[model samples]
Target: MTRQLRRPPETQDLSRESPTVSVVLLSYNRPDYLRQAVASIRAQSYRSIELIVVDNPSPSSAEIAETVAAQGNVRLIRSSVNSGYAGGMNRGIESAAGRYIYLTEDDIVLDKDCIRHLVEYAKERQSGGLVSPVMYNKTEGTIRCAGGEFALGAVYRRRTHGEGERDTGQFARPFNVTYIDGATMFARADLFRRLGGFREEYFMYVEAVEFCARALKAEQTLTVIPRARVYHFEPPADANASANF
Candidate 1:
């Protein structure tokens, strides 16, 4: 109708310039945070991505749908029960239709070039199945992590921590980290399938570690590219505590 035709073009960048990347952003009850997460993806420099927001049983899919209705190429999938991060994200991965699958959470705000740079870095590395960007917490004004390497046996440090430490490009160079945090990482769709996705046993914590271990077991490389970045927000109270998210 003429009225519908009079509507102006939306400011949201829903253009699917490249269909190679599929972002699987898992969400729970945090609708506000989820809104920001989806907006970040919509603002990405890389335009060839399809965003699949796998809602962990959002009570009102209609409300969530209305939130993202204007964002092109965005799909919302909901689970019947509360599936934790592992299970929820696994469902997202299974339904992804891109060559590169990106995993992220509702609290993370990705830099515009995060996906572009990550994909480019992975392409250059060729062998790496997983790639992560440097994570920063704006509220704390500190580096959450650069990337992590395994410690003695099963335990491993999460790279950088401490108020005294600085992230002034000291660990800026990309390196072969032992593993990448799944909160905001890119994985090859085929490789993700080959690894059988995240082990549902993990539920929430250790999902990334378990996935990386399986990838390594099957001879897949994991790397980090400082060029790519994402802003990860954490509560002031839970800033230092490793909460089982």
Candidate 2:
């Protein structure tokens, strides 16, 4: 059910005076992971924040709704059909009422200061159109993506920086990047809305790549803030599934 749960007592007095960060968390069938992700967002150090959970017609929709209702302070958007990553996120983005929008997946567990650090960096780097935190594998304790770049050739290819590398202060500094991973993206609300959000035609994969490409074409900078961190609990690849490429 699409509904806005009552705000928690602590946030009842949240006013529009401060810049608000709207976190658009997309949930598929991973209800357990969604719970963890919501908890982490609730624990964020950034006080001016709103959590919008978009359920993309998961089989476990009832359970997902139950989990969100338990929070009693989040906005949940339930889609009738599974619209994939881009479409689901776009729904949440449309309902966002913040100055900044953060898009993340259910499998992500963010650090308490992740949003705070991202906002700080974005404020300092006003040119940044998209900013993201360094992501590490929750299980293996290795870098998943610090930032990423597109290696366009015969076909489009994505190269994630520091993927599978042990995090040992290598990507410790913030720097410019071609694109921020879709797992976690912090963007100015105006720019994201102006770009019409992600292209729904991509459905799931490569949507972030195309969106970043468009942003770059507009001369906007994309960056990765290393001080902010998130752990990605990526599911194992399907061995039986065929690779078309």
Candidate 3:
């Protein structure tokens, strides 16, 4: 999951059909990172995607609005309150108009082909639903996780693989994962609506996991597409929310 080029993709052919892909980028107070996230989406090779920036209401709401205004085709939704990641994403999902909904943090910088590859892979799957890409730590240039897992019994330690490894293709092959990092997730819009989006009660942490848990109950598959990649930058001290860290 390191942020280096892992050989050129054999095909740049994004998707046979250009279905609208909506990206719900959640940002609380990090304006600079928000701009980077929006710009990265705008720079994507796939042109059919729409960007929905859900800004948790804060003192910097006006500044965030101004920054999002500069980016064409991106819709800015200002929350009346700082309704955590769960609420923000639910609102964004409501506004999304794509066949696929991609969840991302404001601190992430996606590869140009990230959306393209994701949509292509989604169309390729027979019954897959939630899918995510390999997340690389921006500055450290190391693996964050191929996908996430949880240990049973006492601690229930949440684990992610290839934490500090180089981009050597050790965990390169695509596989089914327990949970995908909330930083970047792509799924079908129909399935998301059917699943009722993220539970607004959880607020931030464990919301995605809870959503995936329900998906499992419904017998849906969560997958990882190794070819799709994204750069997850270091987050603010508070982890997106004002004081949720």
Task: Rank candidates, lDDT, best first.
Answer: 2, 3, 1
Q: Candidate 3 residues 1-245, lDDT tens each?
A: 00111221222223447978889998877788788889999999999987889998876678889999988778888888877888888888777777778999788899999998888888776545789889888888887767877532312346776776798988666788777777788887777777777777676677777777777777888788888889877544245344641
Strongest candidate by lDDT: 2
The list of candidate 1 runs beyond 4 A from truth reads: 1-19, 58-62, 151-164, 236-245
| Best of the two (1, 2) by lDDT | 2
lDDT of each residue in 1-245, candidate 2, tens digit only: 12222222333223444579999998877788889999999999898988999988755789999999999889999998877888888888778877788999888899999999988877776644889899989999999998888853311687789999998898768898886888788987777777778777777667888888878888888889899999988553221111210
Task: Name model 2 segments beyond 4 Å from true.
Answer: 1-17, 151-155, 236-245
Model 2 weakest 10-residue run by lDDT: 236-245
Off by over 4 Å in 3: 1-16, 151-156, 235-242
Q: How high is the lDDT of residue 78 in model 2?
A: 94
Ranked by TM-score, the better of candidates 1 and 3 is: 3
Residue 82 local lDDT, model 3: 74
RMSD over all Cα atoms, model 1: 9.1
Which scores better on lDDT, 1 or 3? Answer: 3
